[model samples]
Target: MASALDNPLLFLLVLLFPLSAMAQTNGTISLGSSLSTSDNSSWVSPSGYFAFGFKPVADKNLFLLAIWFDKVPEKTIVWSAHRGNLVLYGSKVELTSSGQLVLSNNQGQEIWTAQVTTGSATSAAVLDTGNLVLLNSNSGITWQSFDHSTDTILPSQILDMGTTLSSRETETNYSSGKFELRFQTDGNLVLYTTNLLTNYLYNAYWSSGTAGTNSQMIFNQSGYIYLRQTNGSVHNLTLGNIVSTRDCYHRATLDFDGVFRQYIYPRNWAGESWSIVWSVPSDICTAIAESIGSGACGFNSYCILDYTQRPRCYCPPNYSYLDSSNTFKGCKPDFVPQSCEPGGSGEEPRPQFQMTELPNTNWPMSDSEGYNSKNEDECRGRCLGDCLCALAIFTGVNCYTKKLPLSNGTIGTGTTKALIKVPQGNSTSQFPFQREMCFSFLEQEGI
Candidate 1:
């Protein structure tokens, strides 16, 4: 038994062995197959359109064990094994010979495992439909990624009763977000905002209203999403299926803003990105307003529909987001909060806050007081004098005062104006008093 180190050429050959294996991977992977992020290798699908392996998370210096559209410029992830956990360099995913799919960290500790109970896997394959399947001895699928889905559902995918899809924390962060789409066991399909810390589902923002009839969520090959009832009747969730499945790739995702949208990308369209074909509950900022929980964006942040038709969250004057990178985390006051206690002589302290105007904006919910006859100035004055008032809404004819954690905030079509009370410091922080100017500034800088 001669050692490989005994010959220099043999040692070099050993170093290059893994790279050679990477190039030879095809549609079907062997039982003992493995890949790693350090080598940047993957088990590519037959058409080379999809891959199952570890991918580098941009700018974060981490890797994700997931499946994605391999040829796309964005390399959009369709499914991830562990959303809350990310791995460092040298991490690898392997289909163990013992019939288990395991993701291991650089230190060789298990991070995630695909659950299987019926039988051991004989082989695994990345199917053309973007599904990663583990086959049994008879080549029957024992486990598949389509069954335990995350946020996006590809064409030909089906969501049976009780299946849920969770949005990511942000566009870039892979952690579970505040929104979710659940097909309840009662046959109702609904979209909801979830308590991230507790996983408690709040009010339903949208629903199919087919409860007790038994329904299944299906994304057909032609790029249409519909709910099929037990009686064989189908109700389309998305209106049209104009995009041909043969010419384009499709996916329906529960976006982090709590909107469910269908998108398509032409197969031959050069240098293009995913285009939204349809969305449900179009006005997401107003759709989720309820007596409990933060609305579409987060507490203390207003939600607006940007040019892209997606929700855009912004922090008001004298308030900054709890996290700058992830606006959905909400905001915090930059200065010390007003003192609610009176002065030493029992006289109320001088007002330390003033109102800054934002036109066409309103915190639709969370009203502390409402005055039918108050004008804009009176609304502003009322909020400024009250230590409990965080904001005031004056809609030309009436006024409403709001407290902390403003919810259901939106850029409305009505004449509603938001008077946000902030510390009477930082003179440059105020937008121009003119309604037009204030709206323009809010739109331009999201102040």
Candidate 2:
């Protein structure tokens, strides 16, 4: 009932409360439901591009650490934690004994971590630019996940491809997957496959120039990364432009959910208006070039740009057709899976084939099981013998195989050699997607 300043003891306690809370935090900025705060139980970022607290999407146990534009009503989440995994009530975000910012729940078990470090003294601060920094008394960043990204690349943030693996395996989930983005010596942004240990992902250029230009722009405030040939060039490479083809203009996130996107603001009250510039399913049939997904061509096929909107799926060169339908039925070579059976006949022949682009594809189930091969030939031999192996791909002198022909939905063009298993009746020449096959009808209708 007494005024804080009038009560010196209470005033000092009030002042000390924030300091104590900060000390316990070890200087890591967090966003989420402030219902867990000891004070007013409200979470707010300094600049407001982000907020802390509970969201209503998931079940009750779900606690999310998310980021979105402060001004926009849609408040699109750029990053999310505990997506499917949620925490129970009574669990609070706290600085743990190990110096990591942990989200602990009622049972006193940790659900998540900021993973910050404290050498001398710890302090967490949310910078005006939206960067949540956990600083040592000396102002050094002991640990930061900014160096590690999920999918959304923010402005002023340097995307050191050298530090991160290539592309997301899926769109929404955050787990390590196949492709990755890299900074090339040529200064172009390239998407490469980590499995191949070479450049399998394609490139999006920022400017026509050399690499290491300080002129490139990554504005965290704007949530876009850009490139300029010179200082403040009129036209620059923007994240929106490079990735808009997928209809993922603003609602873009790079996690395991297959590089999620949205052309229009789905969260907007007026309804999202979007166009697909690049998308796996959207570009599957029509996508050309090596960096698209495997389905760009039919399974066990080469995507030939020679075909119109329907990408031409061709047999790998030298590989005889398994299906006599030849109208582009999935390409199969003379060698059957058993021909190269490890104990049977190890003599597999290699030949030269011409392909302007490789399909973006996923790893075979076998490879995901932790199968290690000495070389491509060994992998090929293994695939041939497995009988379960449906397709084989050799890249960067390494080989990978799957149990089924690449499908229109799952295949991409980002590999060197992809051998798909084709059914005798199916033709690679047939349009992979039903939509593509019916494009003629749409055109007839003035679509």
Candidate 3:
């Protein structure tokens, strides 16, 4: 596992050391007309909006090639060309006799460098759009920092979502934390545990929006990025709202705890910074950390809010407890699995779920697929008929099934609802009364 970036000092040290040599060119690199370096030492951008300079804030130790709001070294840094590596103090960016940009520390050790991935002897420039470009002396942008990003997602920067499963920690210190926002093939954003994945095949659609800056904004008017601000500019920074509201708290942020938050912005000043309008815990697959990790409900069960208990996990209406305990890991089907694997039968049976929410869910790591159906009834038929189908959840008019059961633990949040299909037992005419009696018994025993 990659280490998390929670220690800001460590983050700065690791990221700055190698970056001191940024903008030092060896082969044949040069700067463009629109840009300039901090001390006018050398490197420049194409539009004069950015500069290759040294910053003392992250660490007083070394200089780095950072893309800031502009010439102001203190401005919000949108990107860092090299954040991890040690550059000796007093290192200056010098064009190597080879034309490559090299940073030689006080002792002459090479720190961070920008090498041409393709073309050679190219001129490097920073564009007004905040892009650092490396172009052939002939003037073609060969490589740029805009193509890659550290943790901060800037405007106009294209993000390839859903490609990586884990997410970087928030900006407190710059270390890796929890929380991950991924892209679905269908262009939706899904949140899951950095580690645990789901078993379902259909992709989870948390929110939908355009791919770039037109939709996602890092800073807004209200001073918060994740939550939508009532006083700030009105635009979807990350994902579009599935529902609308005035009193609603809607924030979209990759939070410090390593969890993405689409929460309610606190409207009351005397109150909390903003009570949780909506939030997915950092851990989304296993029942480890408090309710923060994923799959808190355990396998084959769904976690839900218990109005009376505040944040306890509950089995869905149709589901039963796998264990005698009330903990999420205890949930199981009222009915047992017919067979473990798929039979040679014509087609497999389909399972179905009713209306409910699935909170803090990640993609199940198992090899599974989803089946599209017209409605819940259709989904039920599919899972029931299939021998291989174990558990299923219906969302956005589609049914998702798994060979392995899904994590069942859940925490509170209006977001935790989804219908699932489970096997039903053959009950007699008095089944309803019997079920009610059993439920009463369990409730009294606090099962």
Candidate 4:
């Protein structure tokens, strides 16, 4: 664990500003040269606009060996190596005399190595285009950062077919997230939400639909982003007035919220955060509709597009988030579930539950049952009587009941009003049984 090239975290970079940028120690690194977290040094591009070295991740104690835009005075990492395993204080990234670039722990055990499949590297450079490269004796690139993308692609970079860019786990976490932007071998550029911890793909949330051979996703020097085919055809990905690279810095990133955005940072900025000029599928909360898995937000939570067009999760009334630190973790009801068992009289237990009204809210998945209902009160009664019913959608005509742990919840004016059933007082402490015991009983195993 170790840190930055003097970067002060920017609130907009999704980084908290507790740690400041590191002291600048810029230059071309020759073979056998090394940069260590202990010294807080970095190899800066000739224009001094970008740097290659360690930057603070979780804190000053833990660092990510990566590259970032230098002049912004904030470490907005565009590319990184070994994100799953972070380096510590005194750790170093070395260009061995044998020409291999290796990252070693404080104990000198190699932890990460650059895949330098080309000729032996003679030197290394941090390029103004925001690419870090290992150079051959003749200055040819043996390996480059732009070729091995993390999440963001800078102007002049190409996302070659079959290459993928995975979003960070969260705004503050650098590990890979659930969203991915892949330039498929079929020549299609698709945005997907991956099943966490596995490479298994769920469904395409967005795509260019330009399936062919040898298609490349390019963020050109002129500030145009598009998919270029080998046959000289093109599909524009970004739409806006072209901002010259001479006046602004450009980065197309797959944000943690599952949106792919093109950001512009002015060269002569005056305390302004990066601006988003364009984004695909502008409203992810509505765009990420799928039959399987939770919607844009996790289970039991509704999703909406904030003013900035980012997906934000919210818990329904009488429920709370499962994890405060991560809204993507979804929500849980604060009250105990009503018991589904039959009362001693052999009748359904209806008196213990009541309904709460949620207008224009819907859970598209987990429909337990559906039927015609004449009025709101009847729809409410239908859900309250069925212990398995957690929510009932009343569309002014028919009623659709949903079960627990609801998936694909959406809150919008176009959706129907939903009546959620909950225990009358909602205080499990009043019951004779312990909460854990009640939970087991509510799960429908045995008393």
Local distance difference test scores for all models:
0.81, 0.44, 0.45, 0.80
Query: Which lDDT tens digits does candidate 2 get at residues 175-211?
Result: 3455444445444544433333443544331123446
Local accuracy of candidate 3 as per-residue lDDT tens digits, 1-447: 445387788777777543323433332234412112334343445434455554444456644555564433334445554553334346555544444655555676666566667756445555645566667667776666755555444334454433323333334233333344565454445554443244332233234344332322343323233322234543443344433322323334454333445444322223324334344443332323332233434455544333222233445444556654434343555655556454466866633323222433332432255777657666656665656655455554566665545543343333212434443443223111235456656875899
The order of the candidates by lDDT, greatest first, is 1, 4, 3, 2
Q: What is the alpha-carbon lDDT of model 4 when measured against the actual structure?
A: 0.80
Backbone clashes, candidate 3: 91
Candidate 1 Cα outliers beyond 4 Å, as residue runs: 1-16, 19-26, 345-351, 425-447
Q: 1-447, model 4: which lDDT tens digit per residue?
A: 324434445433535321212212344677767788987777888788998888877768788888888888565788888864687788988889888889999889998888898778887888889998888989899999888888899999988788998999888787898899989999988899988866778899898878874568888998899888888888887775778989988899998888999988888886547888899887888777777778788888888665456677877767878888999878898877877766687675545778876778788777889988768888888888788888899998889999987887777786489788766766322222134345645654543
State the displacement of the C-alpha of residue 366, model 3, in Å, after optimal TM-score superposition.
Answer: 23
lDDT of 2 at 293: 41
The predicted structure with the larger TM-score, 1 or 2, is 1
Per-candidate TM equals 0.89, 0.47, 0.39, 0.86
Of candidates 2 and 1, the better by lDDT: 1
Q: How close is candidate 3 to the true structure, as a TM-score?
A: 0.39
- Evaluation by lDDT, superior candidate among 2 and 3: 3
By lDDT, the best candidate is 1
Could you tell me which 10 consecutive residues in candidate 1 have the lowest summed lDDT?
A: 427-436
